[model samples]
Target: MIVNEWCMYCGECAGVCPQCVIEVCETGLKFDEQTCEDCKFCVMVCPVGALEKDEQK
Candidate 1:
């Protein structure tokens, strides 16, 4: 997962993170795929719409 500059630091993504991959940080919100279970729960809850999965295509 990769959080771009568009991140607004909203915690919505973290709230629903099943794997707790998303976390709010002082610099900004971050998404750690290492802890991610590939469950897109957090991706669906981002209010600022800043969260995104790493495009593997």
Candidate 2:
């Protein structure tokens, strides 16, 4: 996923992820890309619209 500068670090995305691929850290979010299922739950739940699919991947 692509986490933009608008991210608020609310942990909403990480909470909704069924795959548990997203982690909320002090600095930012970390995505386990290899384990991701491309569910986009994180994208949809991001209140600040920070997360998006990396189409280039």
Candidate 3:
């Protein structure tokens, strides 16, 4: 997943992630690629369209 500059730092994506791969804090958001299951839940839950699938990968 890719988080762009538009990210609002909301914790919604982290809360809805099924794989527990996303972590949101006061600093920023962190994505654990090792634990991610390619589940698009985070992408879907991001209200600001900050998260997206890394299509180039």
lDDT of each: 0.74, 0.90, 0.86
lDDT of 1: 0.74
Arranged by TM-score, best first: 2, 3, 1
Q: What would the TM-score be for candidate 3 when compared with the true structure? A: 0.84
Model 2's TM-score against the true structure = 0.93
Q: Estimated TM-score per prediction?
A: 0.74, 0.93, 0.84
In candidate 3, where is summed lDDT lowest over 10 consecutive residues? 25-34
Report the lDDT tens digits of candidate 3 across residue range 1-33: 888999988788999988888988777888888
Task: Name the runs in model 2 displaced over 4 angstroms.
Answer: none
- Tell me how far the alpha carbon of residue 8 in candidate 1 is from the true structure, in angstroms, after superposition: 1.6
| Rank list by lDDT | 2, 3, 1
Where does candidate 1 clash, by residue pair?
Answer: none
User: Tens-digit lDDT track for model 1 on 1-57?
Assistant: 767677777688888887777778897876676677877777677666666777782
Alpha carbon lDDT at 33, candidate 2: 95
Q: Which residue segments of model 1 deviate by more than 4 Å?
A: none
Stretches of model 3 off by over 4 angstroms after superposition: none
Candidate 3 lDDT score at position 11: 86
Residue-level lDDT tens digits of model 2 in 1-57: 889999989899989999999999998999999999998988888888888899888
